[model samples]
Target: MKFRKATSENVQAIVEMIADDPLGSKRENYTIPLPKTYYDAFERIDADPNQELIVVENDIGQVIAVFQMTFIPYLTYQGGIRAQIEGVRVHKDHRGLGIGKTIFHWAIQRAKERNAHVLQLTTDKKRPDAIRFYESLGFNASHEGMKMHF
Candidate 1:
């Protein structure tokens, strides 16, 4: 498998992977919806230098997973950056094969290289398996994260 930064060419595959999930039906925030023009995703990712979209490809160059990471810089943390991981998804057939873990480790290392103090992400309470996966990777559930949809 090979991993690389995502480009507009991979948007369709990434969108399909994310929307295929069950939770995405109700939460319109996790992943970008399907049938979108590639330019949309391209513009968004291009606008933010601190944000990155990445993809994982199989040996034949087929995209099988996608995720985005956002780095938030703060002065309170002694000029540290915090990496917020979101929109992580692996193709249904590609799950349980360590692709997710590999991408996550890559993201963590990227964060560390950028002087990030924390790498954080949030999963819906209903995704117990996801929570366990994050915990297994050394992430802790310590804060009460609340969001209000506008």
Candidate 2:
């Protein structure tokens, strides 16, 4: 498998993988012609220097996973960069193939390459398996994460 920045052509596949999950199915509109919002969000991410929207492809060049990494410059860490990963999803057909670990290793190395002081992510409380997987990767639940949705 190969990791690369996601292109416009890969948006649909990415969204499909994302929506394959129960949580995502509740939120994402995965349709024949996906909503304009998805493309617009992709364009914004593509343009941002601090954001990397990525796709993982199989040997045959089929998209098998998707994730986004955001590097935030912070005053709290003495002007350090904090790498935040979100929206990670592996295609339903490709689960349990170690692709998740592979992509995470890639993301971690990428974060280090960018001089990030810490790499962080949040998994929904509902996904115990995801939490365990992240723990296996050496992440800790260091802080309580809270969010408000409008």
lDDT of 1 by residue, 4-101 (tens): 88887777787677767787755534344543545676678968899988888999999998888899998878888999999999999989999888
TM-score of 1: 0.89
Considering only N, C-alpha and C atoms within 3 Å, which residue pairs clash in candidate 1? none
> Global lDDT for candidate 1?
0.84
Candidate 2: give the clashing pairs. none
Estimate, for each residue in 51-112, the C-alpha lDDT of model 2 and write its tens digit: 99999999999999999999999898789999999999999899999999998999999999
TM-score (all chains, Cα) for each model: 0.89, 0.98
State in Å the error of residue 58, model 1.
1.1
lDDT, candidate 2, equals: 0.95
lDDT at 55 for candidate 2?
Answer: 92
- Stretches of candidate 1 off by over 4 Å are 27-38
Q: Of the candidates shown, which would achieve the greatest lDDT relative to the real structure?
A: 2
lDDT of 2 at 90: 92
